[model samples]
Target: MADPFTSALVRHVLGRLASEAIEEYGLLRGLKNDLSALENTFKLIQGVLHDAEMKQTKDKRVEEWLKTLKSASLEVENVLDEAKTVAMIKSLAGEMGNKYKRRAFFSYHMNPLMVRFRIAHKVKNMRKKLEVIDANRSRFQLTSNTTSEDSAGIASEISNRETSSLMPKICGRDEEKEKIVDEICNQEIGIGHDGDDVRVYAKWGMGGTGKTTLAQYVYNHEKVKTHFELEFWVYVSAVFDIRRIIKSICGLVDKQLDKMSTDYLLKQLKNKLKGKKYFIVMDDVWIENEHMEKWGELCKALSCGENGSTVGAPLWL
Candidate 1:
């Protein structure tokens, strides 16, 4: 039988491939054809995932096939993740090259040519494995009857989890929580050169860490509550839709901003945040290479806040 996490992993990989950053990566590295081939292969596999799950109980061959597909899909996910991380690191290093000469060695080690070649080779191999698995499905008479709505249902159920400002009962994290709270509460408000600048404090680590939990404790602390006039908790998830994020920020203050366009929303947000001390928690943010401009735009919109305004982003690194 297929592992329960297999379906979720497959969905995540598909989502990653569909992301703008990956599309840009493909274009830049001349891997557009390879990426497209992988995408098509995954879609074929996805259509039969449900059918295979149901048939595995009745047929041992189907069970083994699911296992093989699951293993190959996981390897693909790992390679994609590694390539993305390397690409992001290299981009950052390039941006800071003038100031950080020490990053030269890192850049040399992560040569774009080498990275592209490695990713291309792995993608070709993974595609071969996936094609073999997809070809076998025909022998088993697997039909592509799984509707998109079915997949949507599963994805929605998995993505429905959210973050909140309500304090949670916890243990062994008081020290960390106190430190973060102090950082937020003690920043001089309207008193220095960078006083009005929105300071960002991010808890960067792997997923499943206590980052969000700690942020919650700090967000709801008595000090935090009194320091800022408005506080918002936004669950950004994987996709960074600027309009949605602005709508969320405005929605928290009982103002319903229209979703017609991002420009209109940002204008309204600027007015709403003007001269107020606000704290926003952008929880579960997964930023890629393409999100920098969007992030900068959001920050510009938030710049209307008064001194001591801050953003806490607990990134799923």
Candidate 2:
């Protein structure tokens, strides 16, 4: 009897709390314990949401409990959103130090200490509300949903799955596929100059949402085939191994290129790509901030293509 919508919301909030972006931003430094407690309590509540949904009509108290849980979950989501915003501002302030001195001056509210102080207060208050919710769980005598398991497994499976240009026929995505295909073939949308960077268009969403499938359709479309001189597809798994990735791209061009050293492959890749329009699908890319340098390295190689070269990838965020 669990509401599918509610379950999805809870799952999204949990993903946010456990995201690497949160850790990278250093949000909730002193209140890590509080955040963990909140996570655990949410899981427990999620387990019994089905039972509560089943009994809410007959028991007013269970209905109230569900209301409280829903409200708290939304509040937590808002708080985390605010944290992400402040952290992004802080990061921008650091990077633009003297370049945008006037803009950076107004970012006092993004000061890490001040930001943490404000968020910590909200988190502590939220924790108290969750405690009350947890206490009410036992009174209802609800049991965990048997189908509820760790979402990590789902994330892992998604990360491990490789995609290709061969996608089975699907529905409800023809309009979307046409739009992206238009962008790829439209000369006005991307740079056609020799020195311009490769145009990258990303399709992002939750796992199994047909992002890859849509990309597959676009890649194989007749217009796409007619528009580019070279095409490649590389599956970038969770570990952003630049050498492995370069090797894959090289192998796609010529299998013997796969055995070369990283530097040699990159040099050859640049040579082979010179003066030719190209289209590449880098599927399942999970590039984090730490991989910026390596990403740049790959871009350098891909940038050697003729005008209108493009790369597409599926993004999670």
Q: What is the lDDT of residue 226 in candidate 2?
A: 94
In model 2, what lDDT does residue 252 have? 46
* Candidate 1 lDDT over residue span 25-132, tens digit each: 531357677777776777767777767777888899988988898898899888887777776776787788755546454465566666677778888898888889
Clashing pairs in 1: none
Question: Please, what is the TM-score per model?
Answer: 0.63, 0.50
Give the winner by TM-score.
1
**Poorest stretch of ten by lDDT in candidate 2:** 151-160
For candidate 2, the lDDT comes to: 0.72
RMSD of 1: 7.9
The C-alpha stretches of model 1 lying farther than 4 A from their native spots are: 1-15, 26-74, 77-158, 189-196, 252-259
Question: 120-235 in candidate 2: lDDT tens per residue?
Answer: 99988888888888888899898756334542233332332456789788788567789999998876675322444778888877656777888888888899999999888877
lDDT of 1 at 95: 85
